[model samples]
Target: MTTELLTPAEMADLVGVSVDTLRYYERERLISGVGRADNGHRRYDADDVAWIRVLRCLRDTGMTIDQLRHYCDLGEQGVTTKPERLAMLRDHRAKVEARRAEIDRALELIDHKIDIYLNEAAGDAP
Candidate 1:
């Protein structure tokens, strides 16, 4: 099925966020500002929807608003900012890896706690 051009509500529904949150992203300049209708209501195209998807993915991966703004600024600057953008991505990647390691440690701790509980229930202390 062909995707329809989305209104703010439709876009919010598609992206699984509130309309207010989408407006906040626009205010923060994280996503492209949607065009307006004759009545001044925002009209979002498929491109805007796609951009929100990418923004959501970045946010899910722990990219901060500041980072996203910086990336967006670099993107707006075109090829002249390519090197800086690459550096930013590389730094973010390192941070993500560190966070992943921390998560792994937390998972191990939870597993250890569960194992201890299981042992106690079994009358076999570990």
Candidate 2:
């Protein structure tokens, strides 16, 4: 079956981002394969949506625009750049993991405070 091409609004809704953000991604070259309708409206195919999802993941994981641009450039370079792409992703993963650990520690502290509050409210605290 052929995938349905989506309009800009539909794509933005599906991707849980604004149309302006989608345009920004296109302008930044973070996503590719976006088509245009005869009326000059932007159309997105499944492949474009998939690439946008990857861009969202990288952006949400704290990758800078320049870093993402470099990654996109590497991707466009074909199979020969696989090693470099892998290295970049690996490094990014490590950074994400480190941030996760920091968030976990902060959550533990917040939980401890909540427990203390609960104990005080329940008259079980010293």
Candidate 3:
């Protein structure tokens, strides 16, 4: 039983990131334990894909690089650090929620402005 490994190009395409980004993450210590092929090229397995997806999600949600480094450090320490990771994730989620609320307010303001402009355009302004 074996899983086919992905080339850097393939991994980048599958993970929706550039090959440079994959290299950057590897260099940044955010991605570790990457397997190497006989030609010494990086080969990504299913586990690598799953972990990179997690990294992408955290980054998309605005987790800072420093925060990600710490997260990855804990992850490297294995399951014994789950509690700390949970705490950090909880904190990050709170910040994301707060930012979401702020964006919601900004969106409401934008919608209001759009409605006003639309009304004015239709000669329906008060």
Candidate 4:
């Protein structure tokens, strides 16, 4: 697919976020401005779209705004923050694992309820 330059709205649509959210991300410095058109409108490329996808992934993984901003700051400085970024990712992974455990417990409870219903229907339980 041709990765053409897109306007803010187009980029927002591609990334599945609102235009306001894209602007907020720009204000927060989570993503860099690609540049501006002659009419002073914001322009973005495929790389910007990819970066927004990363931002969304981080948000989905429960990284708070402060955490994202910190990560972005470190990223701006290049590879010097590799160790710190790894630490942050490890911490986020722990949180994801904990959430997964909670979901598994809930699924187990649901299965138990289903079993109870099935047993009752079979006249195996009063």
What TM-score against the true fold does each predicted structure earn? Answer: 0.86, 0.89, 0.92, 0.83
Report lDDT (CA) for all predictions.
0.88, 0.91, 0.94, 0.88
Rank the models by lDDT, top first: 3, 2, 4, 1
Candidate 3: tens digits of C-alpha lDDT, residues 58-115:
9999998899999999988999999999999999999989999999999999999999
> lDDT at 97 for candidate 2?
99
lDDT of 2 at 110: 100
Q: Once model 3 is optimally superposed onto the true structure by TM-score, how far is the C-alpha of residue 35 displaced, in angstroms? A: 0.5
- The parts of candidate 4 lying over 4 Å away from their true place are 1-3, 117-126
Q: How would you encode candidate 1's per-residue C-alpha lDDT over 16-84 as one tens digit per residue? A: 999999989988989875788788998888889888998897788899999899899999889999999
Looking at model 2, the pairs that clash are none
Best by TM-score: 3
Alpha-carbon deviation at 9 in model 3, angstroms: 0.6
Q: Assess candidate 2 and give its lDDT.
A: 0.91
Candidate 4 residue pairs that clash: none
| Tens-digit lDDT string for candidate 2 (1-126) | 657999999989998999999889889888776789999998898888888888889899999989999999999999999999999999999999999999999999999999989989999656
In model 1, state the lDDT of residue 1: 66
Give model 2's TM-score versus the native structure: 0.89
